[model samples]
Target: MLGAGSLRQQWPPAGKLHGATARGAGRGEPVVDRELSIERPDGSRIDVLLNITPLRDHAGGIAGAVNIVQDITARKRVEDELRASEQRFRTLANTVPVLIWQNDEDARNVFVNQYYLDFTGKTFEDVMGVRWHELVHPDDAPAYIADYMDAVRTRRPWRNLDRLLRRDGQWRWFDNYAQPLFAPDGSYAGHVGASLDITDAVLAEQALKETDRRKDEFLAVLAHELRNPLAPISNAVHLLRHPDGRRRADRLVEMLGRQVRQMIKLVDDLLEISRITRDKIELHRQPLLLADIVHGAVETSRPLIDQQHHHLEVRLPEEPLTLNADSVRLTQVLANLLNNAAKYTDQGGTIDLEARRDGTEVEIAVRDNGIGIPAGNLPAVFDMFTQAHRAAGRGQGGLGIGLAMVRSLVQMHGGTVEAKSAGAGSGSEFVVRLPLAEPPDEAHDGTAAGAGAAPLAGQRILVVDDNQDAADTLAMLLDADGAQARAVYDGPSALAALPALRPHTVLLDLGMPDMDGLEVARRIRADPAWSGVRIVALTGWGQESDRERTRGAGFDFHLTKPVDLTVLHAWLGTRH
Candidate 1:
């Protein structure tokens, strides 16, 4: 046996000793050789060499030597676990619906999962570095880069909306929600984001809005077309019931007229509701006296008031209260309240109209001792086609649109209207509040107050309509009023005839197949040849907003179909 200190001092070098010991081990003997793989003493790998000998000695009595094992069990187990973890990460990335992506501060693609590759139809080699921007929409790439750089600079989450291009050359909206990975020192390492497609939701919302617009438009057109003929029918019936007709004929004509008026009112109500729903109502605001509005509304509703035998009281301030409002629409609002009061009240029921100033607003109240509204029906009363009482034969109830129109018109004037009642049969009161302009010191210019009756005399006018009867009848009416009237069907012909006829006023019809009335007006206005022509639009499209649009398109006036003779006369009198 060799002493340990002597063994160390007299020992051969490690490599040589290992080789000799491995060879000298006899057959079937266990031999161990130790050698250092690493140069550093503190950190080194031990290579454990095992020796294997044959059962029988070599032919010359020498034993055989074998390098049997190097024992790397711990290292192999660690490698297996790492491989399994990487595979699990890959599976997770592929399974999620969101796109998992990693990119550097420059927006260069560092790594993308199999899910991203499948969606983009691009290989890893094709999408790396600057090529990643090509997968984004052209219009969105610059913005995306700016936002990403900003996120990196601020060390914040990278969240934004962007359009990404798909393999089929279509673009989709994506919500990119990402967080910036930071080092221990708070330095930005890279960005990891989850991109979710939001295109479907956006498109669905747009589709819903578009469909609603179409529905409103359809309802408006249907109502207008149905009501236009009712006006003429009502006028004709009124004319028929004269002293010349017998009692039976007079009675029949009156019945027909009443029914026709009811139908017209219903259709008008529907059209008004549709226009309001589509955000198409436009109020033509001007300086108006509240007293005059109330007076006109009461006068217009006199027939109903008389029929109901209702007691009406009106209280107006001695001094004038001037407010900014659309007079015609305000009249309609007051008349609707008056009519409702007359309808719901008993024969001897009392109604009162009161007006006063509250701060900067003028408040008008219509109080009636009538059947009151139910609590639940109060809010729904303003909804279209939702009447408290749904009756087909009764004249007391109506298609529910007037109150809605009133609300819209009041809002347009920067005002509000409200209704209050204790309960049914107890009574109801409607209050309208309008912003009033302080009375100007100067005497009010009565020019707008007293518009002279329209005088359609000795003026040159042109009537352009596709319907022969409409054009001919209008021309006759104009001719009867002492104006020189001419007719043309379309834009080109109207333009061609304008040079010779030199008409001062042109009544243009819209919805023409050959160049619309808008185009005709444009051409006439654009022509240096005819600068003095006053263009008026006559069409079945009667929405208040539609009129404003036509007026903006250069038409001096807009009128719905089945034109009222009185209004026409008034408009003609005002023309330059």
Candidate 2:
């Protein structure tokens, strides 16, 4: 089998092998010459394996050997594919963002991706097969281990848990999940897990709950504070008009009416603040005379100004200033400003109410010479329930909701209100500036406006209230108007005397305890005998919804307390 020439060529080439082949070739053993791929002159590749065996006569000895050649291209291609597959797996494990890890049933980490290593700032030597507990929060580690053991015993897939520290010394909230790996025979092999961060979500949920709790507490206190005066005020109006009461019951009725009106105003201001905060103000705008609305407000506040001994000076322009506004709401704004001036002023103080035009704007100012506002509280004066601190010393009786309403209503009119004062005890001034209206070409005159009529002249009427002086004074005022009148103490007695008295109309108070006005109206309406009777709701609950509710409950009309006897007489005239 020896081919001298070929053996010489192959033996020399194969002798160049390194490692085991080089040593073997140094010995007298056979040298297996394997050919790898080689590029030919035509640019094509061919693989060939050449084998050279030692030639000997009897004993093995070095000699010229025959060479055998075989093509091995297919086997080389298979080896190349195995190397590529191994590289792809390493690329995926190192580049993926997820923390990919594997652990045994004992919760010892066996394999980890490079990302997991980077996240924990650990080296393979420091982390491989390390117990997972060492990386968990000390407080949470025991519970996590107990849960993991339970899951393993039941052969369940791992789920979420909030774990803590990593090797980086940072506490993190992670959602840890793992899947059990099993062999073909269903035997446990290991587990793989991933940890995702969710700390923001947990904190946000807690924040929302805390906010809701505070809102509930605020509402509860507001309701209790608002309702304390309603019952007694209603009952006082009932008691003041007793049949056998003091001779000056009429005067007491006036005083009680003023107090009731004050309460209604307070409640209305609170509700308005609520509505404004919720952006629920719906305006009913129309062309109205600002002068007329302001005049009416001034007249309504005259009683309070008189009681406070404040000198009221009103200066209105001779010409009427007409603008597009909600008449009722505009009146409310003026009333609030006037009330504030009277409330804050000292006895015998002077208040100047003036309306003047400045080009496209009209400014209404209520200036008072009284206890002025301080510099610090001026900015927050329009904030709900924000009151100025007493200047060194002053009285506190108000709930501080009026100016807040004044500002809100003024803004709703597309206007602004500003409070100015030199300093405390130097007096304060509030200016309301609103956009002026374009003049109507057709001129209108207010010369035909009727003169003020006498208080109220009508048929005899009954005045019922629990307070003696209020009832008698109200009766006297009615009597002074050439109208016969009587006063009664309570709702039950008033109802008891209705047949004999045969009153034309009934003024019902809503907040009475033993017999509320709502119940009284219900009872009166229920009786077919009094089908023609008129029941007017007169109470301190002046909210719009409250008015609507009373109207729905069979009241002929809903009027707020501190009734204008002239308006009441007009209503009675129409009813009778």
Candidate 3:
């Protein structure tokens, strides 16, 4: 119903349609297919296509124009909707954290999200047409490409883990997962994929596996080391029971003592490592002279040095050097290093202990011309349960916790320790650095104040333990030290014997059947008649909390079992 006259009336004078109409009328030609927008009386607009042509009169001259219009509103509306949807999709893809991508049917990347571009440091054009594959690590590209091509051919989901090179030139692990994309007509449209960074997770899993492996190795080594001491002790015991044992009794007894001491040392190292891991070991720090500490450590490791026949040298600073540290623990740390050097060195090898002030810190170094540590092991030398490889036929006995304990103890005292070596066959040195302290207000005599006195000569002492052997041996030791000692096998027997013996001191073990040491201590403290007796806890429980518990239960002293005879004698000497 849109005639030429009506169309002319509706259109503006300067409109494209008017120009086309005038040109068609004057030239007597046709203006075909020009698009125009038409507004209705109701204020609604629609798109239309216009065609104008000139009509000829009988005189062969131009006349008015004839116009034809076609509606194209639906097609235009669909185009706008598609453009907006594409914009929305691009915004969503760019906003995510993971790498998002799309590919064509030929497996060429056609579109990639902003994250993908940023990760690879490439533009859209640079990444298109399989150029993104350049970012895949060379080690991972071949398999990745093959797997992707297979997925594309089968039009199936795919997943893979591979390393990709970042813009910074670092290769990081990624978990790539993709699903096959298809058109509305069910034709293959390549794939839509996402890649997530999994570098941290991969590294953590690897470390966990390594730790588990080390734990298994440590367990196996511990079993072998424990069995080593048992064999010697067993042999000595058999020899002592022989018919002619008394003639060779002294030598066999000495061998037995040495084996027992070795086992006790191994157990002590294990306990110390446990304490360090739990952060439970407390340091009783004091102001002490470095010379004294060195002397004590040398004494402690002397027997081992002699056994190994390693010549030891000691070097100290000309001026006295003092440090604020736990005297006992510091001595133990140096002793462990010395023992390590002695055990690893060959017979007649020279070992050196040197102490000197380096600026504000004192450096104590133990150096040995023994089998050196491999360069690879130098970094892990202080790690728990780690040991340097030794030459065959020169196997040394240890639990590999000594250096670990040394590191922990030094760190506790605000110090640092380091192991240094050129490489295998170049010898090794362990250096400990501690902060120097101001000299004490008064000079220290460098001697134990009340030590070296004869032990209790006539004091009555009671030894109580569930292990009969432990109780009898302790009583025998006490009697040798001139104490009237009696052995009781349990806490009840200990409590019953106290009235008859009226002992001045009671050495009680904490772990017993029926009545524990705490109950016995409490009952003994409750009795007014036994109030003056000093009750000492002798057990394997040596933690700080264990000491606190015993103190609360009325124990005057606490001693860890396989008690040091010298320490027990010192306490007994104080009783007089």
Candidate 4:
């Protein structure tokens, strides 16, 4: 309410007031003004200003006192309200979850919330006028302070991720943001700061980015590896057709066959990687002799061993050790390891494959004296797309999927694999352990063993492929073995030749562009005239699914190219 009364009623005593005025009648005296609060009759409050003056005669003697009173309750009430608002704001700032702080125009602490004080384990008094930098992580404080000052000078909102020293004496990450504060008149006041813990979120994001980076690297490496062999194979094909081929034909064909085999293995590894990662690859389990699989792996990797002129020593238990495993897949596992050993070892280096029976499991180890794995990389060697260190001048041809597939296949069969290396030049070893099989009534079938092909004379054979060089070369090889052979370019042409040629066997390439080998085989099998003809599928794809597809399409034999000449001839001899 507004002041409604006169000053005369609120004055001190009347006689005193009159005396003060009488004393000041003849003299000029300074005036003193003071504000005071008083209670009204209804218990309400009002404020007023009182002006007092002393009057003196010309002789300089006080004669009377003069008092002037003014009502000023509104100003006092506005001041009270301002103080109350500030108190409530402090309460709010203290109750929030994040750390909060503020600094004045000169960068002096105006306030720090209870939460911030709690984190620093300091009382409000301890840090009342102190800078906030003391609580920042030692490693991050310099950058933090620089950024803080930059924002202050530019009057810009700023945010950063950094660690702070917490009350428990440990550093923890937080995302902090600060905005400049200004007074009503647009004068610089201070900055308001808030910080929230974001350690986990940042870690998760970093991990995701790393995974994506590795995946991209893997794809690039795979493409480079796959393309390497293709260049040599393509060149070899051209070389085989050159006029000088008559003199160098054997050499060219051998090199071409090696590269084709390399490419097939690469394709198989790519497919196997997908299957292993998705847990889709299956193992066909059976009881087998451990020596048999070891021998197969050794034989498969011998060419590389011989090429490098490495001295290889094999040691196996004198007694026949048995294990239950998928024969084909088990052979693949050991062969991949042995090939890796040969590839990494220097020429004429010593390599050893040793097997032993320990308790309920068999340990097959492939050890080589060559460039070994780096210590830090051993743990990740069996991870998909991971490989041994590549030397500056040595370019080993591989997609880096072999060891990963080996581990996956081994684990699928209830076994484990491990890698060991002294360091980069100290050589390396890989050990695979499989659960042993109990004694069985019958020994393993010797189908996985090697054999030579018997000669078949005057038997008619047809080779069909989209690649002219492949078909022509296969036909020539067969013709050289005393069999009458003819080459066709595609499925349609092969089918066209069947009626007149009446071949005993058709070596069909499954990946032809038009009228695929499968369709051609189906048509040939449906006819009554070619009842005695045997169809063999030759293709680059050798995954279990590819074999299943050919088997379903009426192929009597499924052989992945570049097939061993001995194996191909043996199958042909059987057909004859």
Candidate 5:
């Protein structure tokens, strides 16, 4: 089967065959040639080897050679595919997103993927050997190593949730899984693993759980707070129903008023918090004397502080400090802080409101000698819905939004608020810092406002409401203040009396069956004779939208019900 002339001239190429054919020809046996390949028409190749022998006529003479070619293409193809598969595996490991690693039998890392190398800021040499633990968090390294060793010893699949230190020195969570590799004879060789980043998932799960817990707590606390006032109000109503109530009418009325005031406070807080959460509370900022602001806040909070019998001290910078701020809201802020101090302190405890100017800001601190905030809860004291949970039913507690609202409002004013406490029995302090501004203009006479409240005397006032008690009581109070007062139960009756009475002021209720306050105001304004009449909205609707609509309906002022008598009286005096 050989090409006779070509083999005779050169049995094998001198360059490749060297001395193979010559040796085989001398030995008179066959020489198995090395493997080779020939390219086919399809651009693929076939592996073949030449087996040559001496063609002797029974005399073993090297006259010519018998060349046999064997096709080893199938075996060669399988070997080449194995090598290619290994290359593909390495490429995939290097390109994947997750950090991947492989270790040798000695618990030494032999290889790490490109992701691991780049992300950990480690060179291949640094990651090799038993240096993998260096990449894990210091706190997690020991546990990871112990678990890895156990898995290797048992030759079993393993998994761990670990935190690893990144290149930037930040610790990141990872869910790592590994499987042991083995030699064909079933001896343990090494392990291969991958780590997936799970930081976001873990944090999300924790936050969701916390939110669910807080929601349940908030509902319970809200119900308790609402019921606190309801109980006193209900008791007051029962007391008023008794015949003897008339004899102690003044005391019963006082109790009833206090309970009503408490309920109104709760409702107002709810409305304010809702407005703040929706970014609905608009501030009207102006240059204001800090002393005037503090005085107004003191007036608002004085009733509670006196009720608690807390010794109060007010300290201010004598030079008349100032803040360009919303007087109403800032007054609210200071009052809230003062009110909190009175509520939390024991009867006869001492509380102080102190203010001073630091380098670039003014710091106001409300300090109290009472039950201190817990050390652990100080950080979360201003967190929404988080409470300084008091002892069993002893506290006239609030909805816990007071400080949270204070913080939010202060931050809105470009200020900061923080609380300081000495463990439990050492009392607490809340400090508020606001950036300083220039002094007031010369037109601002240092004489404070509200010092000259005009006496309500000889003024004709008409009180209108659906409730007989409210209308009658308001008229009585007005009459007691030396004013000419009349009470009417319905808007129709008030309208009927309007022409005859020709009152100077109309205190109208907005939620009547026959006619609302807005309609009443409109009808009054329609009469040119009543054009000069001052119309005020004295209603339960106190939302910003409610005020806007009232103004549009020609209401001179919007006063939410269970009105602050000081504010009401002052407003009425101005109108007169």
Candidate 6:
């Protein structure tokens, strides 16, 4: 819009415009479409395209120059804006935590963000154009490619769980998802996708499934174990009722006792495992000689070894060793190992029990020439309710908690236990390592020192229970031991008989219909006359909390049933 004089003023004095125009006029040639910048009168600059041409006079000589200019400021501004927008998008895509990628219409990767590069540990050149799928695990690559191709062909969203190989050469699980992109014309474009690491979540889910499977298997095993003893117990009872039963009473009684003991053992194992898992089992630790403990364990496992007809050998170190541990629990640990060895071994197989001092710790090993554990199962041999030998049909009617109990009990004593095998049929060995203790000034070396104590002759004892059979049998047992023991069915009767009986000791059951043992204990404790009487809780509830409750109710002792006769007798000896 400016005049020629204003345009001429705007052109720089040293610029090429004047020379270019003169050259074009002299040669009769045209110079066209040269880009240049021009300033207006207000000092604002505009981008412009300039064209110059020559003008000729009538004699065909150069005369002057003609010039034209076109403004392109708006187009330049649009291009700048587009570049800035793309820069912003790249910044955001790279800064995000997840992998971000873009592909062209041909399904080739055109761009991948910083996160994707860092995750793959590869340069942009290495990951583009059909090379990205190589990072997927070999086992999962085929399926991943198939799914991606299907999504591309159908122009649909894609989702899959697969393993991807990391830069560290480890395969990890990834949950990949993608959404297909399209142009404004609705034509297909490649997809943008993200992958999330799901390895931990996947492992946790697998562990939960494995635990559920084991639980189901444990329940089935429990039913079978419980029924095995019941069948013989039932047959023994039936034979005892027959007319000719008296002739075979001793044998039938022995069978009945063995079956009853087996059932009791199963129940005890169940309760012990529950208590251990709940962190309720308490250890009564005391200094004891290793030899005494080994003797006790051998005594406990003798019946099983004899029944299996297995040859047993025992070895001990020459130097004396002691442990500050729970005697009963420690004994039970070794006994379980011995029983396991006996049960797994063929009849007349050789079993070895060895103990040695290893530095500040004592190592006890129980080994057998039996069907050894499979190599694959050694790690989980001590897992709860796991019977690695069950499939081989040598489980020997157990609920599969013995080894678990051994490990937990050992660990509770600040120790460790391990199972070793040279694969199945190569024999097996279980080693337990426990911290040693200095010999105490006075150590209890005897296993059953109080077991042969003086009888409760003339000792007045009272038994109270809701189960009539339990009460009667217990009272009979006490009377047979030379105590004047009487049975009462309930708390009320027990309270009524207390005045006349004036017993020295009362074996009370915590659970009764009309009045529970706690109230009775409270009442008995309140009366000064009964203060001298020793009250003991003879009930099925034996958790630490249960013991605490009994103590609060003023009972002298808590005993779980069916109680060990030696323990019961020891308590009675105190009253005597």
Candidates' TM-scores? 0.45, 0.39, 0.69, 0.55, 0.64, 0.68
Task: Put down candidate 4 lDDT per residue, 356-403, tens digits, no spaces.
Answer: 998999999999998998888898889776666654344487767889
What TM-score does model 6 achieve against the real structure? 0.68
Per-residue CA lDDT of model 6 for 384-487, tens digit only, reads 99999998888888888999999999999999999999988989999999999964323332223432332666789999999999999999998887789999
lDDT tens readout by residue for model 5, 1-576: 254323444545467675343344455455546677888799998887766664655564447756677889998899999999989988999998899988887778888899998889988988778657777888888889898989988889999999988899989899999999988999888998899989999999999999898778888888888788789778777877888867877887788787778778878888888889988776655556788988999999999999999999999987767776777888899999899888878899999999998976889999999788888889888977777745423356677788888998898788999999996777889999987667534443223332223256657888888989998999888887667889997878988987777888888888888688889888888889888888877889987889888878887877778866656565665456
lDDT of each: 0.74, 0.73, 0.84, 0.81, 0.81, 0.85
lDDT of 3 by residue, 34-76 (tens): 7779998999999987876655567755455566788889988
The reply for model 6, stretches above 4 Å from the true place, is: 1-5, 13-92, 95-97, 240-250, 438-542, 547-576
Superior by lDDT: candidate 2 or candidate 6: 6
Q: Write down the TM-score for model 5.
A: 0.64
lDDT of 4: 0.81
Off-target runs (Cα >4 Å) in candidate 5 are 1-37, 41-92, 95-97, 103-110, 117-171, 179-191, 239-250, 389-396, 438-576
How many residue pairs clash in model 5? 0
User: What is the TM-score (0 to 1) of candidate 3?
Assistant: 0.69
Q: Mark the regions of model 1 whose C-alpha exceeds 4 Å error after superposition.
A: 1-247, 279-282, 389-395, 438-576
Question: How well does candidate 5 match the true structure, expressed as C-alpha RMSD?
Answer: 10.8
**lDDT tens per residue, model 2, 424-500:** 88999999999876764333211222212322344546666666676678778767755657777678977887788
Candidate maximizing lDDT: 6
Clashes of 2: 24
Instruction: Report backbone clashes per prediction.
Output: 2, 24, 0, 9, 0, 0
Pick by TM-score: 2 or 6, better one: 6
lDDT of 1 by residue, 1-576 (tens): 111112223223244445445434534344445432333377755443343333234453324333344555466568779999999988898898778888877767887887788889888887777436667788888988787788878878878888888778779899889888777997777888889989999799897896686567546545654566566666556666767546557666676677677777776777777776787765555567888899999999989999888899999988888876667888998999888888878798899999998888989999998777777767766654444533222225454566778778787788898988886767888899989976543433224433222235558999999887999999988887777899888778888888788998999998788699998888888888788898889999986767877877789888789886656665666454
Clash count, candidate 6: 0
